[model samples]
Target: MKYSAIITDIEGTTSRISFVTQVLFPYAARQLPAFMQQHASEPAVAEQLAACRNLMQQPDASLDAIIAQLQQWIAEDKKATPLKALQGMVWQQGYQNGAFTGHVYQDVFDALSRWQQQGIKLYVYSSGSVQAQQLLFKYSDFGDMTPLFSGYFDTRIGAKREMSSYAAILQHLQLPPKQVLFLSDVVAELDAAAPLGIGTMQLIRDGQVAGSHTIAHNFNQVEELIA
Candidate 1:
């Protein structure tokens, strides 16, 4: 196998940034207050609310305060784990209600399916919670592509820009870094993975900026890079 595994980013890699920024984030922001009010007593929602409070160093923060804090995080595009978890919970409702299907680029859709059939283990690493990542593929416009992925990862694994995070993922996958390819649109993320010996590719969907990693305009180009 040219590569034993392929790990990919979601936004701007396999999917468009507009889907996350314009759709998912706004949906969560719109429904958060109601979602929190209805689910606050539930253990899962409560746990994340508590985590948000702790992250803000406000142990006694009220439910309203927590809601406000989350809205702020959404606006800032912060990658706070607790915020991501809550957004996933909110998005679960949206997906179940047929609000919108997840968007995956055509090139990515074809490449991911082809790679999976070729026995390259596929994984997702995104700021989105694992639940959110699964939801995207599970309800993708292409329909239920979740089975293509071998696993999912989020900030709980570690921050994407840190070399140690990629090292941790390599350890979990139990694969040599050189045999795993990591694809992302962010240069810093590619930089982090590259030093760990992971093959790195930057998606140049929004035109190119010079970077240390190999660049691909789309997943078809990435296939060429890997081959």
Candidate 2:
């Protein structure tokens, strides 16, 4: 069946996992405390700070205390929404200052471009905040890839491994589950979407972990599957 739209994961799919774990994560960790100290009064920044405090059950938590908890979350690779949002804020500055450009695989660029030309709506659904998602694509190596996507979803919608998350995305997309293809490198994520009848493809860019779902080594291979 021809797909009407496609939603893709970021790390390990369109981009190398190291780009996130090595480049982005470390940058955010090193920069977050200072960034928050400087911008905590700003509304968006304050909102997430308040969220962090609430989630940590420390409504009166000192800014420094909250920052410490956030750093712990970073070290633990926690997927807390406030932490992701704050990281996005930090990353926005990094991207603007040219600390780094987002890493996107070359074949991903080509195949996504081709699919755009074919009139398939594209989207991103990542554990990263929507702001982070936009920042990555906007400051991507290929330059201004934000235009290629129709929308973005983050854990704010739901966790990546939850069927309810894909169900919610389908609501926003207003497309049949079978008509939306979801691409990810993790089999659990593919399993989540597949049960919802969304087409699932795993991107095995590196190791030889196995899954029953369809697998692709690169975007070129992924394109062949959908073609």
Candidate 3:
């Protein structure tokens, strides 16, 4: 009821974790090598490849090694910046080729639309790349919902569990942290944001609310709290 900006996490919050783990992740993993090989010479791909190398601390790593490293990261769902960026690039191809559309819960789309109409600014903070975040909403299962979001933040901003990341987001939004409501299924992420004075709400889609910051079983419940 007091927030001006709403920042939400994607996986396990607005979308099902199964969708990320089962659909998106597997698709990206399967396409990574081929995508990298095809686009290795492209500027964006080349930059991300360099980033992967930097992250790996192997300045002269071969392309084959990098691909293997990326596959391993995907298996672990590591939130490393380079891995996320590369995944976004690979996902872009899938989205464009009509392989799959982004998944969003029905209630999420309704809540986002209603909130947007009420002049609340919506933003996404996900482990996924900002480009991936945009593409997800832009090509969502319910239809294009990107227009509902004002901005997207990814790991490049900072780790989700670090207080500094919430501080940075508050600064970027030019709003007091208290004026922002941060939603996620992860208690640690809510804990980090709360220390920065951001209101925290934990999505409990998996029915485990014992350790949550504030439990909301669905977007409708979240909407009521915001109201």
Candidate 1 error regions (>4 Å): none
Tell me the lDDT of candidate 2: 0.93
- TM-score of structure candidate 2: 0.98
Candidate 2 per-residue lDDT, tens place, 1-227, comes to: 29999999999999989999999989998999899889999999999989998999989999999999998999899999999999998999999999999999999999899899889999999999999999999999999999899999999899999999999999999999989999999998899889889999999986848699998999899888878
Cα lDDT computed for each candidate against the true fold: 0.94, 0.93, 0.90
TM per candidate: 0.98, 0.98, 0.97
Model 2 worst lDDT run, 10 consecutive residues: 201-210
lDDT measured at residue 6 in model 2 versus the true structure, 0 to 100? 91
Q: Give lDDT for model 3.
A: 0.90
Q: After superposition, how far is residue 215 of candidate 3 from its true place, in Å?
A: 0.7
**lDDT preference between candidates 1 and 2, better one:** 1
lDDT, residue 148, candidate 3: 94
Q: Please, what are the lDDT tens digits per residue for candidate 3 over residues 1-227?
A: 57799999999899988988998899999989999888899998899899999989999999999999999999998888888888888888888889989989999999999989889999999999999999888889988898898999998789999999988999899998888999899998998899778899999897655464778989999978767
- Using lDDT as the measure, name the better of candidate 2 and candidate 3: 2
